[model samples]
Target: MWDDWARTAQPLKGKVAIVTGAGRGCGRAIAQGLAAAGASVCCAARSKSEIAETVALIEEEGGVAMAFAADVTDLQSVTAMTHATIAAYSGLDLMVLSHGVALAVGPVETTDPVDWQRTIDVNLIGSYYCIRTAVAPMKARGAGKIIVVGSGQGHNGTASTSAYAASKAGTWALTRSVAAELIGYNISVNELLPGNVRTQLYEDTFGQVISATPAGGEPISSKRSHEWLKAPEDIVPLALFMACQPDIGPTAQSFSLMRRV
Candidate 1:
């Protein structure tokens, strides 16, 4: 089954993609997956070294990719990245907004105002910037796909995660709004929930939560942590599925890999 799926998932042969936050975690994984599926991918991120590593890995696999340093919070930077991708590959078909931060992971009252705004800027507004820039190129192609990497916490807030949750919730709302606007243009906008993948952001945010609990009341243990965590590669199939969908495929929707309680 796996072999068959892999063989058939190569429909993106001549497509082009831009993956934000491609330096590591979900962004890097999806960038690699898209390239393996035959799309020329642009690995965009703030970390020059990290994105370079991602590009190297993709090239080593006989895939086409380029590293672009971009700050999603800056509209000009995002626009430059989009233009560069189009200039390099001729067109853009897919964009995966996987860049985010968890800096304001403490009590709401104590959360730094600047940090909260920065979180909103990177996670929510940054998404808007990418979406805005990709619109023209996608419209030029007459079809496109935009995938927003979101979280379950956006649906129901968790304590000490107010800023992060708020930003994601805004992203979810933004996804739907954009999807509706692009319906006639054949542009599919959607959200993808990657669940509890063990990335650095996860370690810093959740680790802080676990350590703050009272003695004998730990919400997560070392052993349980492993069980709950998942590898970034696990998201590849679902992402490929969404990216490979038809022009008239589902939009203003969310595809989740998270388990229910």
Candidate 2:
């Protein structure tokens, strides 16, 4: 029974994937989902304990995974993650850049330049670090999948989020440029823009916005409010589709779950 079950569930069987910022939320979900589909996932995150928990969950479910301590902003850390993955799993096939940071909201004038810099460093630069290094083995092998978790703000601008918006937009552009470079290599690079899911980041950032508003009328429109935000799991199917189906999937393109109802 165990052997049969394992064989049936192994689509990504021996493939190795590195999911950054996988300590929690979207990254964690993506890591587990890939593992469930038979991928030996390396859950990379800055937090050791958090990533350890993620790996534990995957192992508990009979999936193969490893928790890695890594900071996406540092190419060295990201490169080490890829190196470790190759050492453990023997080959690299997928890279999920799900790491991101959302700073406290405030008007442009009120926003701190340092805070803004940090935002770009995490969302844009950090992603670049992961991609630049991960592409090595992929490019050498001539096949791989790079799934970037983007934000709606990248395409559609939002108020009081200047830094985040710019950072995300830059990340998407980076995705397109890299996709073009991977054209004939069989390496698919695409950006997966997530919807308004009430994860820890969302609650910490936007929750404050709603709280600061004067009592009585709602601050944001109903369409963009908490009531409309879907669970993180709701967006996982599309993420998995974009991830596991690289050959037949679109590359140098961007897809989003922003159309939630």
Candidate 3:
């Protein structure tokens, strides 16, 4: 059944997909993957230069993509991005909220207030804006896929990551609420909780912790762990599957992609 689904499930072909934070990291990978799967992707981010690079890479590989510069934290920018995508593609079929920030090494009480607010604004509020802005076009079409890029920390508590962990947890809960509200419209809303992905974000945040901690003290071991720490490419197939598969059936569910060591 799964093979048959995969074979016949190029439903995303010629469909429009919007991927935020597509400048780099997992977001860029997801955007590229969607485009490769035959979706016309809107690659959005704060940096035009980085988004342009992503678009160039996609076009070089013969995939369709367009770069839109927008800060996900800004509602005006989010609205502009949605409008631009609609103008370019007529309508949106998929919205992937892949952009997020984290300050993982700080203790809750000692964490910088600026970082805390930024994390909440970027991870929680930003996702809401994307979903909220995309809903009208999706409702008009009466169908769409919304994928929230969540984190394993949302499922389980991780020390020294109070703000990031809280924001992701909120994202998961928000996804559930949106899923309930949109199911009648045939919009499948889901969350993907990635574990220890080797993205720039992961490297910047956890890499320091990994480097400082002793071999045995490492949260995710450095040795015999490379195979388990998912690559950005590893995540793309699942995202594509969730977005393209018909009859996703349930709403308000979350899936984890971590391999236990």
Candidate 4:
């Protein structure tokens, strides 16, 4: 099983990583996975209690980690967080921009301006801040890996998800741009589409679990197959694989687990 493999692998030993949105869902899963791979991880998020739980879980598994409360929307907060991670682990080598929001889930014409803007603030701008702050440390170290947890919505259009789509699309573009800019510094930046995992964000936004359909049958969602619904743990392996890649590994590319309908 995957658990057995994780226990035996130490490919990332001595590396230090920072995972945003480490409170729960895919972010928490990735953080735990990185720890299991022998990296010192910093579980960062606005929810102190939630990140504490993540750090506790990592500690319970005998992995090195710490919980840091940080608001990604604020540049100063993100900067302090990056500094703290470096201070704790002596340096930074990996950054995972996994925090996101999908508050504007209605027709654009009828959506609240505040909610729409907030969605962008949290998902797109927050990612920019995290990347901007983390880049300095990584550049200083001469090598780093940045993984952006993107969405299927970014690749194609979908109804009632205008803001979320725009933000993720922007993030995808940003990932490519940053990767190109950091290539000379030996940093690799890539995006990971985790499919439609059954996280709290999914329940709150869709209120329905994506169900499996018969062979060759239509799915519930047109953008992706309903059967793509997965547990957070299902994403860990791909994340670990990307994290374990060489310094010259693929960058500006997207690794997706979601199937198109």
Q: Among these predicted structures, which one has the highest lDDT?
A: 1
Give all TM-scores, in the order shown.
0.93, 0.90, 0.89, 0.93
What lDDT tens digits, residue by residue, belong to model 4 across residues 1-261? 666687797888999999999999999999999999899999999999999999999999999999999999999999999999999999999999999988867666768899999999999999999999988889899899999999878887466678888999999999999999999998999999987899989887764213322335443365453557899999998999999889988999999987755
Error of 1 at 91 (Å): 0.8
Give lDDT per model, in order. Answer: 0.89, 0.82, 0.83, 0.89
Candidate 2 C-alpha lDDT tens digits along 29-73: 878888877889999999999999999999998989998999888
Cα lDDT of candidate 1 equals 0.89
Model 3, residue 258: C-alpha shift (Å) = 0.9
lDDT of 3: 0.83
TM-score, cand. 2: 0.90
What's the best-to-worst order under lDDT?
1, 4, 3, 2
Give per-residue CA lDDT, model 1, range 1-261, as digits (tens).
322465466778999999999999999999988888889999999999999999999999888999999999999999999999999999999999999998766777777899999999999999999999999999999999999999877876666678889999999999999999999999999999988998999988887756554455425443244344688888988899899899999999999887665
**On residues 1-261, what C-alpha lDDT tens digit does candidate 3 reach at each position?**
332343355457878999998999889988988887778899999989999999999899777889999988889999999999999989999999999988635655666798889999999999999999998999887789899999877876555667888999999999999999988898889998777788888888776545444334536443326446777877887787788657446568887677645
Model 1 pairs whose backbones collide: none
Residue 172, candidate 4: C-alpha displacement in angstroms: 0.2
Q: What is the Cα-based TM-score of model 4? A: 0.93
The C-alpha stretches of model 4 lying farther than 4 A from their native spots are: 208-220
The better candidate by TM-score, 1 or 3, is 1
Q: What ordering of candidates by TM-score runs from best to worst?
A: 4, 1, 2, 3
In terms of TM-score, which candidate is stronger, 1 or 4? 4
